[model samples]
Target: MHPHDKGKDRLRKFVARSEPAHPKLPLVHSTDAYTFTDALEDGNLEPRDCDVFIGEALIYTFYGRPSYRPNMNESATSLDHYLPVCLILKLSFAQDLKRIFPFDTGAFANDYYSTFMHRRMGLGDFALEADLDTPGRVITTFFGSARNYLHAAPDTKTQFDPAQFEARSYAALIDAKNSNAMDSRGSGIEIQIADPISISNWVEAAVVPSTFVQSETGDALRRLNIEILPYNVHSRMKPNEYMSTVTDACLTYYAQKGML
Candidate 1:
């Protein structure tokens, strides 16, 4: 097989591992902007998801899939717009939910508005004011999981023993990315994720150093290009803490394999 083809095969495996459950994954933070706009049109007082439709046109719709209860440590203030479309494009993209979330159909929504503009786009001020080091537990989780996957051997078979552990991590990352309350993109501006230098730092610092990651790291990056997108974006967190956590997680990995 061609070396590049070999690389593609590796990444497809890596992403497939941490992509989160595609089935009706627990929905959270998501709101249908279209439905919310209808409320605005008729002058209803009910709460809107993204402070989005207050204007004549809906800017964006935010959505989130709640994970680990409502108040996890990394969770930001409840009112913050976390579930910007960058996290889950499909979930945020609503032509019209044509349906309310399962069991709670209090409202229905569509993606028409959100597709063109994220709720964060409406809050241009808030996005600018957000901090740089916000815990952002969910996005961190996703970034870490992706980092972890990149750390895995390209040929490593998916193991079953670490299922729930893996789930929590992936869910955390996806959750943070989707949750509007804790994320910065809540302001509805087109945010840039890791700059070229920051992304280069990730590969050079962590991914390249992993025992399992080798030439495939750079290739997978080129193929997936998650670094460029700011929405579902995650960053290389605390160098010290990340080192400790990955060390512990790696120990667990080896232990599960009876390798050590």
Candidate 2:
């Protein structure tokens, strides 16, 4: 095989082995009601400059339950206060699209090294043929949180050797023996996709708060044939502890405006 073909073949196998057990696991993209409505009307999920993370759309995958859940960490306030929803993208479709790549940690965190890497190697760059030649240099899926590795001091800690990094799917974080990892909300992994994803072509379903189930937005979702999942089913859909107060304030504001 040609060198380029060999590299591509290896990369494809790597991604396949890394995937979660389910063949059709969906990726979750959290958003507010207004933005979701816009996407439905436009039939696309266009990345806004203000919301872009390293010049691509951000989404999350899970190692636990298969149902849809709201990611409260997506914002500083209660996601429900903003009439939050989640766009469910098919993982198979995203992988087939070839513009999607996974980061072993939350890409938006304040880790300096991770930030530098994101800037230096945009999502697409990590998957390039040249980068694939040395996959560990471009990708590393940690046994635990990558933060543990980043925060360890060089002299006192085990060094991270790029050549020794093992690339695994975010789903691999969970195993029958690791109850703690299984109980966590998510794998802390981030999946980045190239911009302007077509909603009609990519989105498989949506999760909306119960409040919006009868609203105009719900009607629009049905019209588009996107399955509507209520968020209350999943425990993790609740706002984080720190955001409870902020979420309450947002709820009040929305209620005062007669939006609730």
Candidate 3:
């Protein structure tokens, strides 16, 4: 069969079938049915706050080539709604800072600092110019999704409608900072998401879960330790302006050493 036709058939099947409920997922409600804490209890604000503050949080989220919208309920906000397979890598600030921040402040400021702070609300001295070469235990939600073979909605623009497809998971940890470990394998995973039809079934068969344990390297990524400020929730500022506000807030808070 032609690849395009094959993908369409697979997409049709996915739409027709029923996906088993993820046990960890609670029943979601509409926006009118929720309040501020409702979003918090659902694990959006805290992790996101950590992502912003941690200076080195890296995201590995999935999206269709055109556009991919994940499963959403009424309780979801544009800020928090995400597909099931999204992963954010959180590192240990205390233990791994030395190794992870192998690049000096000069390299960071010139090459990465302002750009990351401006875009993703964090800083990573790690070499992303090619592949992730820094070593640290990255705790992320993907650890759970990978184990479950989570489902993600494909792009609607590609003639694939509201069908969900399997999403595989993989993780690699290189113990050496700035090592050419990934040069051989070419960044480990092939992430060129194209037509969901061709790869939907492939995702189901490619579930390779990252293991978690409380080793001396520190505990596996389980919980994030940051909280979103009130302003981050209801800010009228534009994206850049809002980030500036957040950056100022972060700077002041750090300068105060938690006094604020």
Which candidate wins on TM-score?
Answer: 2
lDDT of 1: 0.24
* Position 146, candidate 1: lDDT: 23
Give the least accurate 10-residue stretch of model 3, judged by summed lDDT.
203-212
Q: Please, what are the lDDT tens digits per residue for candidate 2 over residues 1-260?
A: 21111222333345444323211223456666667778778877775542324444434332111212234355444444545555656544533232333333333233312313324322332232221212222223233222221221112222333432222222232222334223232222244344577777766567666667787877877776876666442233444332233223323432443433
Candidate 2, superposed: residue stretches over 4 Å from native: 1-22, 50-81, 90-109, 112-163, 166-189, 232-260
- Of models 1 and 3, which has the larger lDDT? 1
Query: Worst lDDT window (10 residues) for model 1?
Result: 99-108
Model 1: CA > 4 A from native: 1-130, 135-195, 198-200, 204-260
Model 2 pairs whose backbones collide? none
> Model 3: what TM-score?
0.21
A best-first ranking of the candidates according to their lDDT comes to 2, 1, 3
lDDT of 3: 0.21
lDDT of 1 by residue, 89-144 (tens): 22222232211111111111232123323343221211211111111221222333
lDDT of 2: 0.41
Of 1 and 2, the candidate ahead on lDDT is 2
Question: Top lDDT: which candidate number?
Answer: 2
lDDT, candidate 3, 90-193, per-residue tens: 21111111111212222223332232222322222122212122111111112222112121211212222332221110112211225432221211111111
Q: TM-score of each candidate?
A: 0.17, 0.48, 0.21
Q: Which ten contiguous residues of candidate 2 have the minimum total lDDT?
A: 149-158
